[model samples]
Target chain A: MTVHRPQPPEDPDLPERPGPAGTPPRIPEPLSEPLSEPLSRADEAPWRRVHPVSPLIRGWIGLLAVAWFWGQNWFEDIILAVEDPGGRGAPPMEGIPFLGGVAWLLLVGGAVLVLVGLSFFLSWRFTKYQVTDQHVNVNSGVVFRRQRQARIDRVQAIDIVQPLLARIFGLAELKFEVADAGQTAMSLAFLRLGEAKRLRNLILARAAGLRSAPEGTGAPGPGLPGTGFSGTGAAAPGSGVGPSEPAAGAVPATDPAASPDSAASLDPAEAPERVVAAVPVGRLAGSLVCRPLTVATVVLVIGALVLQPVLTEDVSPLVVLPFLLGAAGALWKGFSSGFNFQAAASPDGLRMGYGLLDTRHQTVPPGRVQAVQIRRPLLWRPFGWYRVAVNVAGYGPGGDGGEERSTVLPVGTFADVLGVLSVVLPDPGTARPLELITAGIDGSGDAEGFRTTPRRARGLAPLAWRRQGFALTDTALFARTGVLGRALVIVPHERTQGIALEQGPLARRFGVCDVRLATTAGPVSPRVVQADVEVARVLFLEQADRAARARHRHDRDHWLEENPHG
Target chain B: MPQEPVDPQGIAWTRVSPKYAAVRMAGWAVGTAVTLLVLSVPLVLRLAGIWTWPPLWLAWAVPLAVLALDLVRLSLIPRQVRAIGYAERSEDLLVRRGLLFQRVLVVPYGRMQYVDVAAGPVARALGLCEVRLHTAAADATIEIPGLPAAEGARLRENLTARGQARLAGL
Candidate 1:
């Protein structure tokens, strides 16, 4: 219960503790004072408070929600009164006792804000997080008093999220991807952007099992046993200080200037990274314009605006306002999220920076990617544009941030797609990866060893039968489906969660079955649709064996051991 | 005649206890009755001179059709129970279920997060329990029902041990 004030890591008053190199030095809480009980080994790490303005950021979001729900009706009443002065005769506020309606609304709104602000302030006062070598603990909740801890070894990926408001305040939220699927084990909200970055680095460094020392040099050092045998710590990718000297092993094409704003970028202190994909604004806009939904929305709006006055006298263009609003929201979301999309490969797996108003920087660690899918929409085929999405464990269903979290490349050319894919799946388990990928994306009907749907499946798929195919490589399974909007999903054998063979009544008659390779919840679904019944059966058995064998080859638990570079 | 589908690997499969058919039928009977009562609300309202929407005949026909549907479902319950089977391999467990829409799922031990043994009141009354294998992928979950309670516990233990032994962290 003793209050411990925060101090700089280099404080001379605190005793020095030797720790992993490249980890931000920590000033352990003084052991001299234990107010009520004996200090446990885990409690040695001081429970640091978040930034003071944490509550303001959190409460603002809550306040916006409240206003959205209540203010809309209030505004409508005022607008109705103003528009038709003779209808109600009196002011909209006349019916209220003592206080006018506006005055009452303002009073209620102010009270609500005060209550929300006070509660948030109290919660922020109680909320504190601790980081030890083995665990990251977050204790919060004034009434419920919940304590959540994520084991350092169980860390999957670390994400630094900056919403529009948070960005304005120069603060970020640190979200931890732990062993649990679809749930962020722990999140430390409203830390200074720089502090969040440093904390994430320290945690990743510890998770990689790197050795540390007080004021240790930020260099790629030897890791503990059963990990970092390569001395590069290439297993976890971009964990630890990340080769501060630029040793030049795997990360080629180092272009730190790819992003315009270097000062505002994430991991400013980290080693140089290989710029794999930097989407141009023109390409992103063009790609979006080519989408069927965009076309439909544009046509709908134009038709409503132009034809409404010409056709019916009573029908107004405003009749389609709801549809237009919905379409605008979707389009704006897509446009803003994909703005300035940049993906780079560093010692830390893949680092992606995106969003116009709310920028997010996420690091997907090595071996964490379960599946990768390259998609080409029908309209985008002419431009040869492709979008790449991945399935990573712990990212959760639909991704908390939206599809942008899973989408490595929002929209890019084939070369850009391949560049991003190379960074994601370093060892694609196929020697002829380019040809295989090319075939998977564009080729149809028994091209490059892919087995297409049998002629009998023509009745079932009709348009897509010829394009539908599957190819099993040494380390991955590729399923290609769709005719107009082609998609190729690649699921690494080792990452496959489970395999299933589905035979519906109609498919049974067609002598075909769908082979679904189960992966973590994300955009990429590794489903081999409408394969010949015999082929699917064989695939089911073979894939099971392949997955088992692949699992044996991988050190799944120790992600910091399997050196992709090596 | 169409050839009956068989497991491609020809592995011996374990069938659920036959008593599950009765348990399922009982559960379904209660569910169907509730659904029929709910479906007959419109007819009852029409008869009581409270509300009128579709003609009187249509209102009565809806519940009758639901009754007919439930009868068909009741007839298929035993066959569906017979169709459910599971097999444990060296490194993975295979579960196959369904009659017309058949599916065979193979879940590797290394990928399994946990194992669950659950039994509803009806199932418990029949002294039967179901074993569920959960993986990181929600869709990959496999549930094997109609095992004796003791056997379900044993299966859960066995699966848990295998999963831990092959603990491949997601």
Candidate 2:
């Protein structure tokens, strides 16, 4: 069989159709096709615009400022010590000739100046980005210059993030996710709100054009481009169906000349339409308070306060309370900030916007999603809510290895939960609500079409001591068990990597074994399913075999039919 | 010319190198000793005037406990090694390992991402290297430690080339 190859575009200008009203018009295609041609040379030109150094660099700047302040204090102290030795503790050592005070100021001043200067220089050196007709290019480095470019077609998701300060200034940062390779992502830092939106529209248009392009095109494939911004728009032209489909709708049809103004208005409204669900404030508050990290932080702060007087002897017990209170306030503030979380479905995939103070927007496309996980904490049972997250490739800061993408839904009610899940998994809303299964497990027998396995039933007693596993009727995802301290793991069959049947010497003698399902995120141990060794072995093997087969088939289709660009 | 069967032990049996078991024992011994030595240093320093109390003494207890745990663990390592063995056939690589828990990880040549040959300082001193078979899954990495450096490098090259050939077929 001949390998499919995209035909190269002969004229670069052919792809550069001016968008409505001087805005770059989207290429006329679904936003899922791969680009056939290399990005126009104009797209890669340097000197378009550059980003300030990442906020991480500001930390260095702050450090340098502190050092300068400290140096100044030290200099004054030295002057006093030298000039008045017996006056305080020891007179300033200024009598040590010209080398004492003068030398100190010069040394300290020079060091501080150098540090401040380097911060600015490094920021300038490390932040550079370019927007062109076909792609967004970013080149960053202090010591080793690395270049990353995202073709409009390959752009799977776009995100716009505005820090509180940035929001006040109407400035935002943009991120473009290309594909599976983490290194290929392009980021645009600190653009004016208008400029960022314009850039987003242009990139989205390009992505749509590339998506609609015929297969074997050299362009990047269609998916949600990873945009780090809080908002993303996944707009693609209807695939090959012609304009007739969209034109048949409720909105009035406009001539091509009138389309620009209409499109602009339509574009802004698209953001709201894409939203699947908004996270409830109450549920988010509960989840945050329930987090082990939050609990540990509180415990540590309280312990520090209580022990400070005994340990230090000099520090007052009252001093500890303020510090503890301050820490608690900060935690509460951070949690509250992300309370009104919003998840929206974009043309490319999904965009989740959260956080109150340092608002974060993460964009994930359907294709980049490796797996989905739904977790319900034991305490959350009464509320009928679950936490959902996806395992996507690429490791970012505050991520768990290469597994972290973004939490699509930190905490949401059942309908809101299903709304987000449908974007990631197949047929999510059709599944039964969680309450029925819980009631069934409680022996109310209200659950329909759900039966607990003998192993699961026996396992329930031990599991209830920690947490009981329940099933969502009509969904393949299983809730095996929950513990008070552990996150309630919901493992969908498709995402399970392998199953391990573990038996210790004690357990082996008792004829009970634990079955652990492994995923890319981490190992999820579902406690002793109360089965004989032989049965356990068979179950483990069966699950593992199914997982392996499913993964194989999925990968084959993905590599072959799905990602035509790669 | 006729091709010979690859197994040295013939049908119904497989012979794994005794060196594999020896190397595992050595690793456990060195690991335990180093852990004990590291843990004891803090206690010694605390007895001196160099530092103050709450010197993470509880954290230090973890490694001390680990050292004691390794004694039991060392005894279990052999059975684990015996249960685990690697066999290379024309089509795939089969890795069977586990003790009370057993697993056989099979990787078709086509699915391999890369083969990494690495050695820690201690393993290098023992003239051994580790070969890690990697796939796309971030966490699904399998390592065969304590191979001779030459064999490790050779295996890496062979697997890499074969993996490339298979990828090209796709």
DockQ of each: 0.66, 0.14
Tens-place lDDT per residue, model 2, A471-513, is: 4322234444434422434444444543444555555455555
| Fnat of all models, as shown | 0.72, 0.10
Measured with C-alpha atoms, the lDDT of residue A27 in candidate 1 is: 30
Q: State TM-scores per candidate.
A: 0.81, 0.62
Q: Per-residue lDDT of B72-123 in model 1, one digit per residue for the tens? A: 9999998999888888998999999888999899988988888888899989
Q: Which CAPRI category fits model 2?
A: incorrect
Interface RMSD of each: 1.5, 8.1
Overall local distance difference test of candidate 1 = 0.74
